[model samples]
Target: MRYGTRALLSKALLSLLLMAACGAQAHFQELIPSTDILTAETGNTLALSLKFTHPMEQGPVMSMAAPRRFGVMGPRGQEDLIDRLRPGGTDGKRTFQATYRAELPGDYIFFVEPAPYWEPAEGVMIVHYTKVIVDAFGAEQGWDQEIGLPVEIIPLVRPYGLWTGNLFRGIVKQDGKPVPFAAVEVEWRNDGSVTPPSDPYITQVVKTDANGVFSYAMPRSGWWGFAALLEGDTPLKSPDGDSVPVEAGALMWVQVRDMR
Candidate 1:
């Protein structure tokens, strides 16, 4: 009998341990814009609304901050940023929502982590992240143009973390028609730092294609300011042999000149 009792007690303790483990795996659900594709003007403020299957416990501390600890990597390998979702005051009917906004034009990713009290037993916590592309022209015009230029900077595969490239493409309208350029000159700066390559692990330069489209690439990653030169006094030679300025948001020049 003594042996049997001991065995039973051991089983009970094991079951309790398993139950506790299950309880610790709470997760999030019902995230709005689950795949949030925010196409907002540069200066416009937007909110990211999130809902969950389970209500978050009141008074639990939450946090929202950019993820920077992870090292810079290509688009596929980059880590997502974590933003804490705070209860935006309860609705009369008990529904809850949280919101966030993009203040600049570029790519941004966001994720969420719930506090311990909000977790559920045997459930997996969900972390959601998405890339948002903000249009710079929207900032000045307050509206997105149908034929506006879009720029993207991509990194090339290189060793020693130093090889990168950039690509620029836009529609230039002349006589009410589309004139596509294969290349253009691009100039960019980091957040108040005049250091070479700005963010250390990146590269920014003017690039052109046989069709007059422009592009640039960086070896590193960080917040960067950039502009395109349609036509200007060329200070430096470009890889495609075009004279252009390294400026930010200069695509308008090309449109204006073509219109003349």
Candidate 2:
């Protein structure tokens, strides 16, 4: 009887662990532009989409409240774009969209500071500081400039204009200092055409090196997002009014094209 009880207990524990693992899909804050490299042909106005979801899984997008902040830093200067955000959704889940017309030839770094998201499964609040770069008229300047997000991925690469299989690299920074050995998650924006064979195929995981640098090569064409997830220094209150840890994510979106 004792042995049978122990077996049942062990089985229950294993089942619980498996359940937790299954629920732990990587969450991504997507800040994607219509075209990374814009020209007269593509047009001057850039359409951007914002969403909280699992990119590779192409999710069940989590509901996103209006972000705390949204803007762009261009060659001239920073412009607040919060007022232009239009509430929208995909598959019934909340999302956002905005548009910006680039008049001059330079890099426009669009960024967002989202409100705290409470994750019941992890018992934590998540805040992703997300960014994407759009090059205007082939200027290609300022793609590497840091906007100083609370947690940010400073791209070592240009963040745009790349062929498939090009290696993208960046440094993970927290509070303006490099975060050595930070955990980074990489996912492709699946278009409902390709399905991952397994859970591992959904999100590829990588870690920063001793110098806080992480790199990943794109195996497919489309948008790729690199998210450096770190624990915030301070905890925030959950919806239940409990103090919970914060999962701070510094995310950057990049695009790669297949060479025709």
- Please name the candidate that would achieve the greatest lDDT relative to the true structure: 2
Candidate 1's displacement at residue 50, Å, is 29
RMSD of 2: 7.0
RMSD of each: 25.2, 7.0
Model 2 CA deviation exceeding 4 Å by range: 1-23
lDDT values, one for every candidate:
0.28, 0.87
Candidate 1 global lDDT: 0.28
RMSD of 1: 25.2
lDDT of 1 at 9: 75
Per-residue lDDT for 1-260 in model 1, tens only?
A: 69999767754553453334323311122223222223432233445443322212221223322222211112233333233334443342222344444545433332232221212231212221211222222232212232221222221211111223322233333222332442222222223444433322232334344433443443233322222322111123344454322211122110000111
lDDT of 2 by residue, 96-133 (tens): 99999999999999999999998887666889999999
Error of 1 at 36 (Å): 11
